[model samples]
Target: MAALDEIQTIVILMQENRSFDHMLGHLSLEGLLPDVDGLRQEDMELTTYANEYRNRFYWPFLIQDEASVIRDPPHSRHLVQVQMARSSSGKKFRMSGFVDSYIQYTQHQTEHPPPMGYFDSRGAWMTSFLARQYCVCDRWFTPLPSDTQPNRCMAFTGTTLIDDTDSRLIPHREHVFDWLNARGVRWRVYHDGPPFFLLFGRFHELVGMKYRPFSELAHDIQHEDPGQAPQVIFLEPRYFDFFWSDEPANCNHPLALVCHGERLLHRVYTALTCNPEKWARTLFIHTYDEHGGFFDHVPPLPIENPPPPGADFTEGFKTTGPRVPGLLVSPWVQPGKAFHGNLDHTSMLQLLAEKFGSGPEDYSASVNHRRAQRIRSLSEALADAPALRPIPTRAPEPCPPMPSMKRQPRAPNERAFQKAALELLQHEGPIATAAKYPDLVGAPLTP
Candidate 1:
């Protein structure tokens, strides 16, 4: 049998707005996984020089938990350029200026900006536990430096013709769901609420059949026939964008507590691992969509061949963004192993293409060019370890109780992608859009 045949299920859970250094950098401090590429003694602290009005230096301190962050830092394309501080020659990325950029866009001034902070394993227990028990990709970067939607577009369609995360509906492109459907691969998207796939109008049809509520995941795992179960699954945590109402917003966006997301992870992991037969053949992956303007020590790798331009984006795409947390949980991966190969959101597409073959050759030109980049495949991590490791018996740490909702004014730097998405819904008619996104019912479009 082919190597791909050995795996019967692939589950991907993509979270939001965290950098590798911000989330898992301190993993090494625990000393459980010594070989992992995590924070060292010298890396515990980082300093950024700023001269907004006078010469000043800012040093990053370790944040105790995620809830302490009051404001969502600006992560627009222009602001990210300031954060990276690429050299004039365009050959070197300095990875400085975070404090300066945060201060420049923030409406409220504070003595300490949240952008200049990192979290240790204590606060990110689920992420740390998953990384320690399976594989962590230290070199995995987001395909773009912008905000949520663009990098998410890269993950779903293997290209982000548009650069920002405005509220506009994505242009018609070959989505991963379409690819899986074409190849006769069974797939499903289990989301806590309104599915992100709804953002793309083209995927509306599949939403009814393949999309499901989060509750159904556990039931399906326990009762669905193993042969008929979805071969590919995309799990979505409760997105923080819908937090205006009383709901568990567990996607781990800056405004929400990380503990909520950790609880979701624990539930997902328990559901998948409960059955040994299914667990042995399943490849579970957890990753972040983008760095969300957090501090990452490693600079993005340059992309030689940018994706073909779209109507919205004439400049084309170039350069991967900062490293984000990537964990591959599988029995096939040896415990404590770290994969350092360069990877990004498109790497998921590359792996799918390798396993199921690329969909219709003419489906998408931009996707074809991205494939030509020869990105590393997720399957590569399993090549060295042919035998399965023992299933984990320990339970994840208990998550703290959800805190009270403290409504705050929306950030002034809301990205264009979010605005565009909301506009698309409005165009469809506000009443109907309100039925789907209740938070935006009476909400003003103006920031």
Candidate 2:
């Protein structure tokens, strides 16, 4: 393993749904990265990756106005099963069912489903710029073939108790935070609103110093003591459930303006680079939790293991979910290359083990199973020494305004988060929970 000790801190900013093909596929379509496994012209011309619905086949088309709000695609467990179109071979897939799956959710609005759309470099300016200037992992798949919660569960815990975004306190073994804590690895969360961890428990530290607002990240990056700095920092964007808040959701969830996520990326990157010496010692990872029902050409590698007994999901997944865009930014990585080694969300855990634990298997037994399956870690993306002497920082992306919502929780994930907060209220008492997560608990939730 590379001496990752030189990389003093690892920062992860996991944005919401949106796939590799939908977000950074333009890198391939525009011929900017000839070798990238993104969208292709022939796939469109020959209709190789087209999906048929309502007696019409929908091919990937460029979204001319990505700044405008679009509809969310279907991404539930059963819906993703339909979307994958698992072939008789079981290992391979037709990979052409996104449109059919989307219309399954929104039956009446069948004209031009969002899953069949692609964004140009200008549309996903921040992501495209980063991929071009850093390392883009084109083969990074969501660990689970389901909705946001389970996939995120796999990302953080290396396993899942639920397959769908069903509302409840997510029961588990050891979460990533617990694992880090047990090993004495300092970690922190910086969030724009209520941190997503509120969905898990009502621990005192979770509501205290362990979580801070994104507004404080710049100051911390510039001024925090190097030895006392957190080894792992998680950045949480404003989620869709906070639509009633003063700020618009910038997580790139469907129906959200894409530029908002770009602005958040710009904000975080600029802050990290403000101190070049600190930036050189930091590795920033920007990826999404799942595909959010967007179409991607790459089928997930075959899923082989079944969840342990008593998992909320008993039916074993046949494959990982679709490929999501993953970017690696640091002075240790060379720019302008696509790292094609197969990776899943657990790969990050493998990296943590290699860095701080005994070995790759030190993450968890579940994560070791993936390591046995050749799931590569983020460690491979780093060099033994810093490759880029003077790291390049891209120009700030000009973010436009997105239409705000002051309505009830309409999205499934939004309602799920609301439900988790409700559980927290029952466990921690109304006054305490509400004080901890004012906006999240103050807003009325539906049963």
User: Candidate 1 — worst ten consecutive residues by lDDT sum?
Assistant: 45-54
lDDT per residue (tens digit) for residues 108-176 in model 2: 455567897888988888889889988899999988888888888888889887788865666777889
How close to the true structure is residue 358 of candidate 1, measured as C-alpha lDDT?
Answer: 47
Candidate 1, superposed: residue stretches over 4 Å from native: 1-3, 45-54, 107-111, 304-309, 358-368, 371-374, 384-389, 398-400, 403-447
Work out the TM-score per prediction. 0.86, 0.94
Off by over 4 Å in 2: 67-69, 89-91, 109-111, 423-441, 445-447
